[model samples]
Target: MPIPIELSLHRHSRVLEIAYEDGTRFKLPCEYLRVYSPSADVQGHSPDERVLQVGKEQVGIDKIEPIGHYAVCLHFDDEHNTGIYSWEYLYRLGNEYEARWNAYLDELKQAGHVRKTLDA
Candidate 1:
């Protein structure tokens, strides 16, 4: 069964406090979440068509809209708002953030893109 995620927005800190039904809590920066959104813009039509997001150090969640019982829509200040993040998908993202983020950085390095870590 997929775990339920209760994500609370903390505008002051620019972080999303994501809590899982399994007792996991993640304080994810908005920029990190925004850059990795599972939308067609980022994921593309297939894995081989994925596009790397660059220069997202200043991105923030402009709004969070509810989507039925399946997901939440994230509107980014940078104008990215197509993804509907399901609880199951959000849980997976939080669980694999560190590893996946590192992989993203590696890919960026290979492509000569440098990532700027912003303090949230």
Candidate 2:
């Protein structure tokens, strides 16, 4: 599995920058990470039970706790700190960001939740 060489959180931008040993990097929005958390609280035990996170567009990371050599636990400012994001999962999230994000938007639309656009 590809491992991250560095992780940087930009609070002002609400983005997490991940640099992998494979020379690939991903700038993941805090909202995106929060919504797609790997914890059972977010992902659930089964695919059909997955929870759809909304109104997290302004969420930011408060802390990142390392879990040995395998993963890190993210503490979101919204008090979500259950997800243990492994290196492999993080890499996949980065690689599949476009598709996943679009899917999330579609889900929100289907649920009649309109996402508020943040000012740049």
Candidate 3:
């Protein structure tokens, strides 16, 4: 797995910037991270138990906390703070961003859920 040498959260843009030791850089969006969180609350313990996160279009990260040398815990403004995003998982998320994001949107559409708007 590529190790992250730097991580920055751009609040205005709502993106997490990560630079890996191998020179791979990714600007992951907060909504993507929140919807794809690796926490049990989101992922659950099994595929059947997984819950689809909805209405987080404008979610933002409040803080990031490193967990040992492996992962970082993201504290979101929506009170979700359990996901420990490892470098490998983060890398995968970045690499497969478009596909995952599109799939998520499709899932939401099929479920009759819409992203939260300011007026919502």
lDDT of each candidate versus the true structure: 0.82, 0.96, 0.94
How does each model score on TM-score? 0.88, 0.98, 0.94
Greater lDDT among 1 and 3 belongs to: 3
Q: Which pairs clash (backbone N, Cα, C closer than 3 Å) in model 1? A: none
Highest-scoring model, lDDT: 2
Q: What lDDT tens digits, residue by residue, belong to model 2 across residues 67-91?
A: 9999999999999999999999999
Q: Summing lDDT over every window of 10 consecutive residues in candidate 1, give the lowest-scoring window.
A: 1-10
Worst 10 residues of 3 by lDDT: 111-120
Superposed model 3: Cα runs more than 4 Å off: 116-120
lDDT of 1 by residue, 18-103 (tens): 87777888788787788678899899899998888888777778799989887899998888999988887787778888998888
Number of clashing residue pairs, candidate 3 = 0
Instruction: Report the number of the highest-TM-score candidate.
Output: 2
Query: RMSD of model 2, in Å?
Result: 1.1
lDDT of 3 by residue, 1-120 (tens): 999999999998889999999999999999999999999999999988879998788899999999999999999999999999999999999999999999998999999997675556
